[model samples]
Target: MRHTFAELFAPAIVLVFSSGCTVGPKYQRASVPTPANWETPQPWRPSDPKDTVPKGEWWKAFHEDQLEALEAKALDANQTLKAAVARYAQARALTSQAISALHPQMNVAPLAQRQRLSGNRPTSGVPITLRPVTQNSFTLPFTVSYEVDLFGGRRRNIEASEASLQAGAADLENVRLVITAEMASDYFTLRQLDSELAILDRTVATLDKGLQLVTARHEGGIASGLDVAQEETLLRTTQTQATLLHQQRDQFEHAIAVLAGQPVPGFHVTTQELSGEPPALDAGLPSDLLERRPDVAEAERQMAAANAQIGVARSAYFPSLNLFGNGGWLSGDVTKLLNVSSAVWAVGATAAEAIFTGGARRAQVKFAQAGYDAAVANYHETALNAFREVEDDLTGLSILNDAKTTQQQAVAAARRAVDIASDRYTGGLVSYLDVVSAQQTLLSNEQQLAAIQGERLVTSVLLIKALGGGWDASSLATARIKPTIKQALQP
Candidate 1:
């Protein structure tokens, strides 16, 4: 029988067009329980639904220029973040590789060789005389093969890869969010140390003057040696406190340096006390905002990929279709290669069905289903945690804000008591012990205020992180800056 190339391929071409379908189940986001009746505390203002999470340059909301600069450095140079980006690139490459399965693969080989027939070799017991013959062989050949996606197994693989790539992207964004929040927390903590150090220094200076006063009064016979000794001891204790604060501040400074990807030893932050209250944040209901978290988005994408894998597993039960073709020119004379008489060609199509596998294919289907169920559970767990975090931060900020107000009043009353006690002591109306107690109370109150203020700032950063720092899943698929692999280098 004689057949034209088109006629030989006609059946397969028909299958490719007429029988293509995806057997895999369509992806649906699993239902998760969202926290209902979420309330925004009085001091925290509610925002537009669209502004659920903190948005781009969210750190700028704190109005700390140094923090903004440090964030930029981390984004550009942090080793952990760079590693995540490299992983995303690798995932993207895998996706492209999977998509390549849908199209034909072709390769060509050019050959030049010399061959000889041995005279000593038996020639089927022929009586004719044997002779040595040598010749040059030149050939050019091309081979091509393609698997038809008649059952869409290849397409299912592609779907899984693409979903995994999106998940990789979301993971990168989650890493970014964590790093930025950590840096913010560390920087504010350093500033908090600065404020405490300043408070301790003031206490030390005031105690030094009190020591001088008590010593002079003792020499003038109006005070006893005991008062002078007690005053000196108090001054030394306050000095010790200031020294300890210095050590703590240096440690926090080192942390900030590391966050900025700089050497710890030489890096220095000028002494600047933490100032002002936690900046105002856009607050809202949890249901409207939970999806903004990258971790949540990553989990959802994981489920999607697993769903596609189920389709891939089921697809293995259907028959596979493939087409193969090869053509070449061959001749002993190099100049005669590619001539019509030297041409050779072949074409074929195959449909293969796996009749048995000892239940391996069925097991794969069950395994894929289990994976999807696990992914759904993880997604729900993540969502629940997100809600919990928001509630904790909101309540924490509200209580702490109120506490700071009461603490400021206590500091003021303590300062007044110290002034009154000093006056009474100078008039010899009371023991020096009274003045010492009042001074200690005043210093303690001031230090407590600084500590509380620092906590407020740190808590604010955590709250912003909980709200997704203005990042959302909408941009998870677009990806950051990347160089494209051109067509020839890619699929």
Candidate 2:
């Protein structure tokens, strides 16, 4: 009249899996305020995806082969990115471990032993019938144990782990974007330094010529020795600036080398002037940033993970249901261990409820709730910061563009002043001090222009990174568990 173990567990398994019932509060994404559009002096116009949005090889937009190559090298060899990849792999492995709890566990253990029975042992109601004896026994046992997930506790754990894995993936992508942007920024900065050094070299040459003229005029009593001294001072000062520019270029080149995963002593970028403008960027709807930026995606994923953990904690309030079984052969003789008559088998179920822990379960639920609230706050904060970055870049680009134009005019006026001062000094109409002042102005204006151009490029890179470097949440949809570096790097 008693049911077999399979019959007893069959209904429980069916009900647990098919009921579609889960404990704890269901998840709903926490909302935060967002602006409808970006505020800018120049209204943004929609552009074709090919022109605005970064696609594959975002660095290609810079139109620099060296920069593109550096980006590729960094993506492949950067140590920080590799570390992020490792963390993502670790998260994936943990997710798999959590998923394992949903399935039954099976293990095999074969045991053999010798036992001794004592005649002195107490019996029910009789005198001793035999002396001490020894016996040999053998067993080949297999066992299976499974939690029914009657309240979906294990399912919630799996959910949390999966969300964590996704967050880790987002982190990896964010690191990649940041490294690539850094490499590009350094590359452009080196180029700008080259431009500045070239300007200084030319300025120094011009000053040398003026110094020679002043020295000749002073020897003929047509100019004062003070004029010669002034010209020499200007030439030497310009030479010193050239030396400093060389030092800065060296530092920037070394940074590029490190980013490209090479020894600084051996790596170098060829001298090139900063030319060409950064590609145009479009600021999409503020709402779209939530899905585009990897940091925001990561934060949102953390929130989901925290929400699932809350469910996991709430499920602790219910008893756990587990079914276990073991079947094997046992006999006094090893040769008879496999015989049907020597077979032994058993099956059973267990349910454990936390009857007392003084309020531990409630505290855990509160802890999980607090974590969820923190995650939500973090998510909103990240989104707001992202918006701020985009706006900052937008305003910077507009202002820098205007400054570049003004700087160009200043450089031209300074050049004209230098020419006029030299002509007038040679004609004995003005003192040599005017020429020195003009030359210094020209050099300073040129350096400022070069710096502004470099900053514009760096800001462009920053904007691209803020826009997620062509990454999106869809990239994590497959949720594949990539364990090896080779697997992770695969396209």
Q: Which tens-of-lDDT digit does each residue in 391-431 have in candidate 2? A: 89888888888898999999899989988988998798988
Candidate 1's C-alpha runs over 4 A off are 1-19, 39-42, 45-54, 116-135, 479-491
Return the clash pairs for model 2, or none.
Answer: none
- Evaluated against the true structure, the overall lDDT of model 2 is 0.85
**Candidate 1 lDDT over residue span 1-491, tens digit each:** 99999899989878765569988799999987776655646355555454444577678778888889889988887778899999999998888778777657888899999989898879898888888989899989988888888887888888888888989998998888888899899889888888888888888889888888888888999899989888788888888888888898888888777777888888887888987567776656677565688888889899999999999999999998778999999999988997999998999888999999999999999999999999999988988888888778888898888889999999999999999999999887999999989988998899999889999999998988888888878886574223233533343
The lDDT for every candidate, in the order shown, is: 0.84, 0.85
- Candidate 2 lDDT score at position 258: 83
RMSD of each: 3.5, 3.9
lDDT at 487, model 2: 37
Cα RMSD of predicted structure 1: 3.5
TM-score of 1: 0.90
